[model samples]
Target: MRQKVFNWGRYPQGDVDLLPLYYLEELDELTSKPCIARGNGRCYGDSSLSSQVISTITFDKALIFDKKQGIFKCQSGMQLSDILDIIVPHGWFLPVTPGTKFITVGGAVASDIHGKNHHTEGSFSKHIIEFEIYSGEGLHYTCSAKEHPDLFHATCGGMGLTGIITSVTFQLKKIESVFITRVQEKARNLDEAFELFEKYSNHTYSMAWIDCLKGGNSFGRSIMMAGEHTTLNELNAKQKPEALKLLQGSKLNIPLDLPSFMLSGLSVKSFNELYYHKILGKVKQDKTYFDQFFYPLDAINNWNRMYGKHGFIQYQFVLPLSTSRAGLVEIMEKIRNQGSGSFLAVLKQFGPQDGMLSFPMEGYTLALDFPFRPGLLKFLNKLDELVLKYHGRLYLTKDARMDAEVFKASYPNLGEFINVLDKYVPKRSFSSFQSERLFG
Candidate 1:
């Protein structure tokens, strides 16, 4: 059936033919066409989009669980939320999870997602044991670190270009409680934020929310949050029962598209100022549920609608530690001058790079959300220039308007990634609109 499909950002929508796969046998028929596999539509951009899109949601299933060993083998289409619901109560948790649990295992593998604990745990692909994948050429392979290792590495972060993942096997981390002993510290400026990150690097998890609207001495004012998993013994009797729960609260939904003016510079500045002080008023240390700490925004259903009908762009980039401060300040200054306010700006530190095309590196990463406007595209193009100048790169999972030249410049390994794709999937049958735009 023909339908409109878009990534999580809700920008650059496309009309495509949605092919639903209920059985593995159906892949043989889809091999004749150019297509890409899509799962839960959680990727922020066009990486999962194609004229002929294959929907994998029907393949969702939990195939096996090794309770004692903490290993989970499941179909690629299974959502992270489903896995958490089944394993959290069993004292097991995801080794690494992105900000949201609404994504699919295949999507996570394709993006090679990183989390707050990336300084120590690495990306999602680190925990993967093996996975079954198929090229559009009717070839199926079981890939792992020790078996078909080349295909395994390429497929993990190849963004659905290598092939369509069928099933995955990975290990899970054991947790004593679902609550996190989260600590918050308000950084006076960008420098202090960096210091706090280093000061708390010993923690299991760390992330910062920065105020992008402010400049001068107040530039990069943020609240750094560091968290560690709580132990069962630490929780009192009243908190014990709730510690095992996953999502314990209600959700609010944006029923319709909001007016574009709702997110203007004035409104955003006001919100950021209030939010910064709100966190300042909170206790330095407190206990919170895992869901609340990790996926607070998920509680708002269809939250993208708040950006209005024109949608928004989620710009995320990483710069080496040596140049992060200067590069980040320049970009923030450009945004402030443009009168574009990113209320949801997030800053975090990333460890060494792992996957062949993994987004993270040994440096700092910042993510921002900007509602679309008449001159927004041009403004982002300028930001790309700054990113390239600082030896930084953009995240494909959150990009929509980046061109081929910028993509090549940012990802230095583009040639290697392309060679691997051509060597295995010669026909390049597994392709997405993004694949054509950036690598075709």
Candidate 2:
């Protein structure tokens, strides 16, 4: 089928020939075409976009499950949300998950997504035991940390450049309950927020929502939150049932695309103030369901539409711990000075850069959602310089408009990644808009 496809960000829209791959034999047939695997289309940018896109949604199926060992082998298209629905009730959880559960298992591995818990648990690639990939040569190979380690590392965070992931076998963390004990801390400014994060580094998960509009003494003021999975014993007997209940999919949705002006500076400022006060008023929240703690935005379906038809860009970057504070403060100040409003400005600490092209490092990562507008690219380019100055790199999964030069500078392991690609990928057999843009 031929159709238009835009990423979750809704920017850089384009038409593509969507090829559906159902059986394994189809992989051989696809070898003659220029293509890239497409999962749930949750990626924020063009990483999954291609003129000849391979739709993997139909390939979703759980092939194997070992409840005792907390191991699962499933087809690539199975979504994290679906997996969570099945595993949470069984006391097993994904080792790492991004903010939303809408992404597929293959997408998670391809992007090597990290979560609020990355400071301790690392990214999704850490838990993957092995996976099967259909490479550009039209051959299937099993890649793991031990077996075909080169291809394994490359494929984990390779962003579908190496090949189409067929199936994945990964380890799942065991959980006693579906509840999480959350703690909220109100930071007067960015400095305090960083201090609080360091003080609470031992927590299982941590994140902050900063008010980027503020300046001087109030610059980077935020509400920091931390969470730990609550054991069954930690929950009151009466609350156990509610906490253990499996989460349902979101039915609440934005019926229409909001006008771009709806997110104007004044409006966003008002909302930020209210949110800051709301979180500040609550010092702690206990016995929250796992879904509530990790995927709050998922409650509102099609939330991206709020950014309007032109769409938005989610710019997420990480800096080394040594330069993170200064780098972030400078970037936040720049945004404030530019008079741009990013209603969603998130901050989290990452442990270390593990995967070959992983976005994280031992530092602080900040994410800002900016609605697309005139001069937006210029503005992002400026931010790119700031990130590069501090030796930071943007997250490829969320990027929409980063220049190839900026990308090359950000990810130093690009050579290694490309070397692996060269060895496995045949000419014009596997490609994406992003790969072509960044390394074409």
Candidate 3:
């Protein structure tokens, strides 16, 4: 049935026919139409949007779990949160997890999602052992680094254009507890932030909450957080009893769309100031629940509504390690001059690139949330030019408005990715609005 659907960002919404695929058999029947697989719809943009969407929500099922080996197999629709519930108590965790636990296995593979540990563990596809996919020709193929290598690479970050991922088998990281030993350091400026990141490069996970709204002497001031899984021996007396305790349900929620004015420059600036000062020290150390450290925003439901009815776009891009410092200086100046500041700005160091279309590379990646407003798109386009000038590219999973020319210039492997799609995806049989927008 045709219905309106929106991604997590809630921008570029459209009405599409959503076909629910309940059983594996249904994959064959859906081949008659050009459709993209839709999981929990947590992607930030149009990558999952299409005229015909094959909903995998009902296909969720845990197929096999070798707890001893920390290996799991499940249907594409199984959510990361669900996997956590079953694994955390058993001392296993996702090898790589994005900021949210609301996305599905299929979506993870499609986006080749990276997490705070990208500098150490790479993206989600790195841990995937193999997966089953139903191609546009209604044929099932098992893909991995050793088998159908090209399809595996393309499908890993193909944005669901190559086929519908039915099931996935991946390795999990074993943990002694569900708590994280965290250290927070205050960076007075951009240079200190970079210094801190490099200084603590050995930490299992690291990221920074940057104050993009601030300028001059305080420009790029941030709280650099680094953490590692707390071992059983490191747990406090009170926490030892529940070392592997699972995260409880979130109680906080944004019940309604906040007024647009709530996110105005003045308001956001205030929030940033408060958040930055909340640490109360130059360096602080503490132990927190895994969820708090890895998925802080997940504690609030419908938090995207905080951006207001028009929604917001998450602009994430990476610059080569050599040019990152200079590139960010230029981009930050441009944003400041334009009077557009993002309160929710994140900075992380990525280790290396994997997969044909994966977003991560050996560099620093910055993500910022900008409220959808007039002139914002034009402003972003200008920033896009600066990004390309630095030899960087925008993340496809987070993109909504990048032009075809810009995308072509950024991704040098576009032709290879397209070749994989052309060979496997029958003409118009499996595609998305993003694919059309970028590849057309």
Which has the greatest lDDT?
3
In TM-score terms, candidate 1 sits at 0.98
Off by over 4 Å in 2: 241-243, 280-282, 426-428
Residues 1-440 of candidate 2 have per-residue lDDT tens digits of 77899999998887988887788888887656878998999999999998888889999999988999999999999999989988888889989999999999999989999999999999989999999999966588999999989899998878898889999999999888888888998998998999989988999899999899988788888889899899877877796776556856557899889997889999989989888888536376666778888999898989999999999899999999999988988898899988776885999999976677888899999998999999999999999999999999999999888899999998988889888877877464788899889986
TM-score of 3: 0.98
Model 3 per-residue lDDT at 438: 90
Look at candidate 2 and tell me the lDDT of residue 326: 88
Using TM-score, give the best candidate's number.
3
lDDT of 3 at 2: 84
Tens digits of lDDT, candidate 3, 1-440: 78999998999898999888899887878768788999999988899889999989889999999999999999999999999999999999999999999999999999999998999889999999999999966688999999999999999988998899999999999999998999999999999999999988999999999988788899999999999999989977987888988767556999999999888789888999899999998999999898899888998999999988899999999999999999999998898788667776999999988688898989999999988999999999999999999999999999998999999998888789888877777485887899889988
Error at 235, model 1, angstroms: 0.9
Q: Which ten residues in a row have the lowest lDDT in candidate 1?
A: 274-283
Q: Residues 369-432, candidate 1: write the lDDT tens digits.
A: 9898899889999999999999999998898888889988888777777787878898888888
**Candidate 1 vs 2: which has more lDDT:** 1
| Clashes (N, CA, C under 3 Å) per candidate | 0, 0, 0
